[model samples]
Target: MNGLLKKQFGLVLMLMLLAMLMYACAPDEAPVDEGGSSDEEESSSDEGSSEDSSNEGSSDGEISGELEIQYFVGGYGDSWWKEVISDFEEEYPDVSVTEHAGPNINEEMRSRWVSGDPPDVVYIDGAGSSETQMVEDDQLMNLTEWAEGIELEDGSSLVDSFIAEPSTYDGELYSLPLVFDAWGTWYDMNRFEENGYEVPKGFESFMSTMGEIQENEDIEPFVTTGQHPYYFSRGMLYPAFAAHGGNELLADIVQGAEGAWETEEAEEIMSNVEEMVDAGYVDSGLGALNHTQSQMNFLLGDNAFIPVGFWLPNEMEGDKPEDLQYGFIPSPMNPEDEPMAIVPDLRPLAIAEEAENPEAAKAFVEFVFTREYAELFSEHTGAIMNLEGVDLANNENVPEYLIQANEMINDPEQVEIFYKPHPMSADLETPISDSLVSLLLGNITAEEFIQEAEEAAAEYREGQE
Candidate 1:
């Protein structure tokens, strides 16, 4: 009996040993690979994400929608615009850009808006009736909301400059600044140098230079249009105001603050224009001539200086000789102040409120904001991009002096938004642009002009209330 029990115990021990061996040999739990290998997988995933982001830069050459864009016939039909639109259509096969061009864009827009079929986007140059009216009637869409939350590839915010601020009302953006056609004087460098005269800096210096020209040379020192009547005010009056104390004085006047207009500063500005006319520094033909003819006279060397802006270059395209050394300078003022000033007005692109293709309109606006388009538009317009990182080259038409003038205006301290904030009136602009003309023509005394301007401003302020 003892022998049989011992044998049974040995058999049980053997079975236990075999089970232990099997457990030891069973794959040793395969020592699972730790996070070190997983790092490779993570890197691959990151690279894929980076590639996806790169693909999203400025949208691929793929667009498929029907688009209708309306531009001023004056600036349309350029090679760059043609190429851009063609490329856009090729990318977006389904999209079509049908341009409606005419001399009376405002009339066309007004009719279209009344007919309830306004184009997807309409351009405004401060000439299209009233921007405030459009906003109040809800005929224009608020662009602020559309522009928000959209970021460029480098994650920069889109267009922080308030080029459209004056047009904004009640803290809402109604339009986007398509082009900033700032105003200044165009000079003939060769004529100035030949006459042994330097471009004047301030009011005193400017008049002295003109006086020298008057005494030594037979050419009129400055020539501008009188019928349009706004040129002198913009090129002469506003810049003078800026030289005195920047936009503060004009702002006070527009806002009807204490002692705004009728100040010595305002009188000085009027006197400057009057003195030019009285001294025969302005063309004798100025009172009867229109803007085009005035510009033509300058191109023909009958005049030495013109009060104009960037569009002058384009308008004189064929008329101006290739070697004509044209230059632009800021309106001369007192040297005690900033050397130059910028009058910020916008040529805006607004989406109609009742647009049928709101999505497409938004898409087109984004396309316009793209760097590629901005660069082309800047070069073609003979203007620089308000947006950064754009490629630009100054031609002979845009002389070095003009480029310097542009730079000075772009300087932060010298730039000011023209017109008053929300409570301001377009009616005020009419008077300022008109009264200065009357002052130049000697029809109204400087005192009378200021008084009339004050009254007009008061009426506008009351209406705003």
Candidate 2:
């Protein structure tokens, strides 16, 4: 009886051991919920759902919305915009981007702006887009607080990375300058080399070099668009003003101060221009040509030099001769001992005051200002971004001239940068552009130019009142 009882106990122990082994090897069942479904069953159902998985990896795991972006497609084109937007969408997978972009996008979107339903982000450039006007209309959000502390991908402060600060009104930032453009003189290095012409550094050398070009080459010495006289007024005249009397004179002139246009510095610069016209250095037929025509003429070697922006090469890219090596120099209006002055034409990026997707808009703004994007910008547009520390020299795609120009622009010893406190009003710029045309054509003397400008400025101020 004792042997039989021992055998029973052994059998019971073996059965219990087998049961535990089977339980450990088998998959555990999830606890049932009140809805008659287990957690694992619900997870399996959701695994096949495309909608539920779409928000994965979104910004903060929550930034899902439609982001509307407006950009001007000019010399820079829309390639950069398209690529950046694609990259942005990938980073924020749940966000859908709608682009309002084209050469005439600014005008096409004007009604929306007027209706107070502007795009979340706007690239303030091309025709019909003015940063100052937008700010005056209270259309842009104040980016001061957010921009001040925002960190870039490399951990640098966003504001600190800008080559130039965002324009501020009463210490409040509204727009961020995205494109860093400066008006300067452009030439063909290959032509210069073939002709043995030295690049001018100052006023005296400029005259001498132009004289050589006129006497030797079949081309005119210099050419600018008389139809768009601001090419001369802003490119040459503004830089000359800054070089002559520093940024103070430029500020005064831009502000339309009473005698700003009538200053000795202004008179001297205008006289120098008049001298160039009198010497036959300027193209007499320029008045008949628009901006592109004038630029094309320069490319055809009809002129040795032209006053324009860095956008020149890109604007005329398709028409450029394969051998046309680009060369750039600041206006060279300064004295030999003085550094060349740069009057930057900054194109800003802003968020609308009523942006429905402010978070996404802010994220887009921050994404664009990185060093990586700056390099990409140079590659796509052959132009510089406003972001600092971009190494374009090592970029094989960028033209040699642009690389050299960037070096000169960033070197304090080589250039002195300045800007108008604000963009000149159309009322003021129109008269100035018109007078500049007259002055360059030798139809008006420097004195008359100053007097007319002062009168027009006074009239504008009175009208403003």
Best candidate, TM-score: 2
Cα misplacement distance, residue 340 of candidate 2 (Å)? 1.4
lDDT of 1 by residue, 297-343 (tens): 88887777787867777666789866578777667754535455556
Clash count (model 2, backbone only): 0
TM-score of each model, paired residue for residue:
0.76, 0.84
Clashing pairs in 1: 63-92, 65-95, 202-333, 203-333
- TM-score, candidate 1, is 0.76
Q: What's the lDDT for all of these models? A: 0.65, 0.84
**Residue 23, model 2, lDDT:** 92
Against the hidden true structure, what lDDT does model 1 obtain?
0.65
The number of clashing residue pairs in each candidate reads: 4, 0
Q: After the best TM-score superposition of candidate 1, give how far the Cα of residue 461 lies from its true spot, in angstroms.
A: 2.5
